[model samples]
Target: MNEGIIEGFNRAQITDETLVKMRESSARDVDNLPIIRENSAALYRFLITALKPLCALETGTCRGYSAILAAKTAASYTDSFKCYTVELDSVNAQEAIKNIAAEGLTEHIKVIHGDAAEVLASLSGQFDIIFLDSSKSHYSEMLPDVKRLLRRGGVLIADDIAYYGKTEAGEVPHKHRTIVNSLRAFIRQISEDEDFTAVIDTMDDGMLLAVKN
Candidate 1:
């Protein structure tokens, strides 16, 4: 596709009305965290619409809100969408399962409970899209596994990349410094790696879109 065509395609997919509503709905119902800000709903919808991915994986399945949004968006193009979501907390996992079922999307979403790293290790299939929204401090450690799991041409979305000032120089806050260091290293690794081309956007806090080669 030409530049205009690609840009238009991205715009059309990003602006779906139903998808926008789903994102807005997520913010209202789920625990309002800065990381899971409202913009992610739209961003996720845009990604699904553009990629039309059949298989998607999310590292964090908090309340199942974002997973539901992703599944709903992916289903628009494919007859079915499989969203494998991992949550470390059982309570959150149970709630997500109920919410997903309540959304009438039990078939499209699969909820897994365990440490994300261990859970990811056991998975076999390559993903068309992967969203990293788990522990920020572990972002760097997760990159190798994430790379293995994502298929070439697949998209990897990272949230809160620019927030927490993790990449900023010097005088880091004690609480967020570790996460900051990890994100900085993680971003640098993706940027320098020959296997991926990435674009970091400041839409909400920060969002990074990396496409595997």
Candidate 2:
């Protein structure tokens, strides 16, 4: 995938060396971890810089890779905004806390450990951007909270919506049939909802980008 550039501003905040090191070191320790893909991460980073969100929320914080990118984007502007991320696994959350701190982003990025649904419900105040990377099946289940928590005109981005194109073709693996059905519902809901304007980018895995009315 070609490295993306955000014209004019010189995205020197996240250096190429940093991304390469992360993609290398992260995969070594994590078995089956769904770290954000190169182009996907670049696209999201571009969104953060473009949107200039004052506050951001992320459902899944896998070792803090995406969280770091978010925090860096937040830091690139001002310290007033913060990035809140949650991870269901205690191990991943703890590792994220350590890694974020190592990068001196502990203040900008806070890692919460628990089921995303419960954690999101407990959160107070709205956010300018929301990122979902948890179980695809849980998306529609969480849309109520997501809609309520997202500020007017806020952005919501969800990953892996295509399920390897199974969602469109209706040929789902037995083990992943439930997820495919749920994702299909999720995609349909966002696209048809009156309060939101959405589009699906056919990246490696699909990405649903929506803006609330």
Candidate 3:
């Protein structure tokens, strides 16, 4: 990956030394996987600066890397900013809570353990930013809830939009064909729906940044 392209995608204005330290320390503890390999700390930080969301929602809490980054960025912009993260795996959820706390972000984040869909259903207040990072197959099913939860003019940032069997057109392999089809449907909804307008960027897997219209 070219440095310019990566930095541009992240909307990085000035390179921060602390971000590098966080990444280095984070890599030492986290097991590298395909989904986890594409860390979006920079993107999260950019969003926090750009939107200054008072309340943010994340669908997945993996080791608390992104959540911590969001919280750190949020701390500078809003006095009451907080991130509510949902994790399906009990072990990951508990570990994520501890990890966020270890990063001194306990005051800015809350981890909810359970199915993200079920958790979203119980959420009362609207969020200014919604990050979709859970099971790729469930992304389509999460569309309605994401739309409902996001406030007017809010942004929805979805990662891994074009990967594995997921393509610009939502094509996928036979074994995971359903997920592919669902991804296509979800992408179409985001693109065609007048309620939202999206810009798709091919970086760190495909990233779709959609703002409510």
TM-scores of the models, in the order given: 0.84, 0.89, 0.85
Each model's backbone clash number: 1, 0, 0
Once model 1 is optimally superposed onto the true structure by TM-score, how far is the C-alpha of residue 114 displaced, in angstroms?
Answer: 0.9
Q: Give the residue spans of candidate 3 off by over 4 A.
A: 1-22, 25-30, 33-40, 169-171
Which regions in candidate 2 have their CA more than 4 angstroms from the true location?
A: 1-16, 28-32
> What are the lDDT scores of the predictions, listed in order?
0.80, 0.84, 0.76
Q: Model 1 misses residue 56 by how many Å?
A: 0.4
Flag regions of model 1 displaced more than 4 Å: 1-35
- True lDDT of residue 208, candidate 3: 81
Residues 36-115 of candidate 2: C-alpha lDDT, one tens digit per residue:
86567877988998899988999999888898887777677877778899899999999889888888888888888899
In model 1, pairs of residues that clash are 166-180
Candidate 2 vs candidate 3, TM-score winner: 2
Please provide, for model 3 over 83-165, each residue's C-alpha lDDT reduced to its tens digit, 9 standing for 90 to 100. 99998888778878887777777888999898888888787778999998888778888888899999999999988877642
Strongest candidate by lDDT: 2
Give the candidate order by descending lDDT: 2, 1, 3
